[model samples]
Target: MTDKERLLQYCLRQGDTHIIFGYRLGEWCSKAHILEEDIALTNIALDHMGLGNAWLERAASVDSEKRSPDDLAYRRNEREYYNLLLAEQPNGNYANTIARQFLFDVYSVLYYSELLNSADDTLAGIAGKGLKEVRYHYKHSAQWVVRLGDGTVESHKKIQEAIDDMWRFTEELFEMDETDDIIAKSGVGVDVSGLKEAWKTQVSEVLEKATLSLPDHNLSRTGSKTGVHTEHLGHILAEMQYLPRAYPDAQW
Candidate 1:
């Protein structure tokens, strides 16, 4: 495929990923363990959704597609989604959710940092706007990770379990493919592989400060990059797409 085509596909895939994951995260709004956390989760969810809208609009413009952002987000099938498996993993417990968010926020901050220097002006602009939101998300999640990991015995245990359970899915975040190759070469994106070392350093340092051990288990899961996802995505998509799918062209 041509460079432009590859770039467009990458953008669309990334946008779809954010929308689906954001919709999933929104489910935690009033369901969090505490009021402050609940509001925080929802606010971050809005940020994700907002970024998704920008990316999707750009993707549609690039492809000259007629579908609206809502359509692209809600109408797509599960197999068409490109989000990492970690995002779709069921929010098992408070600690589990925080662990997932912590890791994702780390990667996202790094990803957007590189994107700010993108050769494509639109992508750079979006990244610039997104960096501020992501910075807060990372800080919030990092603080929680530390608290949960270093808190009471029960909290520590739960957070460690979360870290262990979620660790495997992190491999996908740094897994680069042909789409990454095109974008990196074109200066429109960062190489996922290049981000891996820095991500590892940051994550490991946080775990240490939190008094959490690095997961000894070495088995890592992948595949979401190519649209392969876990079973959880089906349910997430069903809930997220219900309004638009059922109502068809209805808008607020």
Candidate 2:
């Protein structure tokens, strides 16, 4: 494929990833155990949505015939989405949710940091703006991870279980495919493979600080990057696309 095509596809994937994850996280706006955390999670979720909008707008510019950002995000089938599986996983307990966020935030910051220097001007600019937000997200989520990991015996146990349960999904965050290869060679997309070591180091440091143990299990389930997601994504998309699908052309 051509460079333009590669760039647009990369942007679409990034947009889909963020939009779906943001919509999921937004469900916790007023449901968090602590009011402060509720507001904080929603604020971060808004950041994700904002980033997704920016990337989707850029993607739409490249392929106007496909659909607008609204349609791309709200109208796509479950198998068409390119988001990682971890993002679609249910927000089981607070600890599990936090663990998921922490892991994603780490990868996002690193991904955007490198994307800031992309050859594609729009992609680079978007990454430049997103890097700041992701950095803060990492900090906020990391703090929570530490808090829960080291809090009390019960809290510690719960958070540790969350870490173990979610750890397997982390592998997909750094798995690269043919699309990634093309975009990375063109200097438009961050190389997920290269970011693995850095992500692991950062995660290890944070877990150490949290007094949490690393999972001895190394086996990881994969495939979401290629659109083979778990059963969870269907439900997530069902709820997320409900209004848009039911209303058809309705506008806000």
Candidate 3:
């Protein structure tokens, strides 16, 4: 593929993760245990949605197919999506959601730190803004991880369990393929593999503060980067794309 196509694909992959994770976070809008958290999560979800759109718009600019941002986001099939499987998993409980957020936030911090200096001006600009928002997101979510994990015996057990359940998906975030290879070589994309060690250190510090133990299991399930995902993604698309699919070109 050409460099243009590679960049577009890379941007789309980033957008996909943001959009799907934003949607999952939105699921907790009214369901959070407290009103303060309810509003906080909703706002964070919106931030993610906005960030995702920015990347998608950039993707549209480079797309030879000339697909619009909305078209790329709402009209894509499961086989075409490149989001991490972790983003698509159901928000089982507050603790489960926090576990997912903490894991991704840690990775996002390290990912964007390098991305801020990317050779591609547009991607670098997006990373510049994204870094600020994700830093707040990481701090917000990390505190909760500590609270729930170190609070009570019951809370501790539940949060630890959530960590274990989500552990298998974490490795997928750092798996690099050809798309990443090209971008990294050109200094326009991050080498995800390099982020692994730092990500682990950051996560370990937070987990220690939370009094949570890392899962003994090292087995990680992947494939979302290759358009392979868990069953949950289909349901997400079904609900998320309903209006766009049912009313093509229709707008209120």
Candidate 4:
């Protein structure tokens, strides 16, 4: 309701998306077809975890109660999470994972780069570190998208299918609402809606090189802005938060 409340929500939304997507990347550990890629995904996953935690810590700092970052992440129910719908989608296959990663990486690179100018110093600092990390992430995923998309026919088909599957969720990345309205007015938020055209152009160029067709859909997956999410988020939270919830007093 208040500006501070909206900023806290903004931080939480960004934090949730990063943490959830980091966990998704972690799912590839020991599961990637190649060992090098397995390590790469894990490292990226860790980077995401750090980035996520930074935002969560900032969110906690903003909270009147001064909650811990873990308290926010490990204690919240699915409905309380505000991650992008794209971030929480399942990793169906290597192609599927790459497709998902490619899309998000592009957006992440653009998103964080712009956030470098945020009016809030802490958020800008987070963006500075996050920008360096995701730029590498984008390069990695973008190359894979091209390699698979332009490779064998089977590879192309699978990658294309993955793209189509993930395309429906892409729109959620740029949706502006009360949170953005509040935060952007304070100059603490990047106006993501303004990034859509650039995102589309960069995406189109990559798809062109990959020989992949751009997917056009009349509808997109939505609801993340309002704490609405797909069913997968519940399952992810069940595993991720199980330890904290089960052993609230346990000290490791």
Which digits, one per residue and each the tens of the lDDT, describe model 1 over residues 110-148?
Answer: 999999999989999999988999899999999999998
Best of the two (2, 3) by lDDT: 3
Clashes of each: 0, 0, 0, 0
The residue-by-residue lDDT of candidate 4 on 67-148, one tens digit each, is 8999999999999999999888998989999999999999999999889999999999999999999999999999999999
Clashing residue pairs for model 1:
none
* Residue pairs with clashing backbones, model 3: none
56-166, model 3: which lDDT tens digit per residue? Answer: 999999999899999999999998998899999999989999999999999998999999999989889999999999999999999999999889999999999999999
Q: Name the weakest run of 10 consecutive residues (lDDT summed) in model 1.
A: 62-71
Residue 179 lDDT, candidate 1, scale 0-100: 81
1 or 4, greater by TM-score: 4
Question: What TM-score does candidate 2 get on C-alpha atoms?
Answer: 0.96
CA error at residue 176 for candidate 3, angstroms: 0.5
- Model 1 regions more than 4 Å off: none
lDDT of 3 at 250: 81
